[model samples]
Target: MNTQLVESVIQLIRSLSPEEQAILQEKLFFDFAYPSTPDLITLALRGGSFEFLNDEPDLYSLTDGEPIPCP
Candidate 1:
């Protein structure tokens, strides 16, 4: 982490009005709490390998919503 950049950010935040600071705080909290899908995908890819659990092996009739008899 860059100490200078962090200090700069802190200074900028300190300069904001109370309302603006609160809004910024809320935004930061939300950003950390619920990350975007792309962020999640990147994290998952970095953590480990990804593989499909099932490759759609069911019959085409099953996928077509046909009322097939169940064995």
Candidate 2:
């Protein structure tokens, strides 16, 4: 670990107000709990399951509010 970088980050975090710290803590927790979409897709592809989504009938794109048009 880079001790200097760690110390700098710690100092920056400590400079935040209590409310800001709480918000940052919640965001970090959420990030740890849920992987990003691209990360999830990568994991699914590695598991040989990503293609199944294409076969599903009721799937929709998360980026756009539009439904996925079936072929």
Candidate 3:
């Protein structure tokens, strides 16, 4: 991801409450498969999980079905 976009997402995530943050973390770790779209982003924010959203066609798949590696 681009630095700016990643920064923006980090800012948005920071704005969420701890419980919501936990939900997002759990999804990121276990449920979400990324390369998500704007709609999927919205769904994740609304549902607290990415399970309802479909895989994004353009974004790259998460290799080895693993959680995103930490920087």
What are the lDDT scores of the predictions, listed in order? 0.82, 0.87, 0.79
The digit string of per-residue lDDT tens for model 2 on 1-71 reads: 79999999999999999999999999988778978899988898798867777777975456758676999
Q: Model 3, which residues run further than 4 Å from truth?
A: 32-71
Off by over 4 Å in 2: 32-71
lDDT of 1 by residue, 10-37 (tens): 9999999999999998888877798799
Candidate 1, residue 51: Cα displacement in angstroms equals: 21
Worst lDDT 10-window in candidate 2:
59-68
TM-score of each: 0.42, 0.44, 0.40
Candidate 2's displacement at residue 8, Å, is: 0.5
Candidate 1 Cα deviation (angstroms), residue 50? 23
- lDDT tens digits by residue: candidate 3, 4-58: 9999999999999999999999888866656558867788678857654556454
Score residue 27 of candidate 1 by CA lDDT.
89
Residue 17 local lDDT, model 1:
100
Which candidate comes out best when scored by lDDT? 2
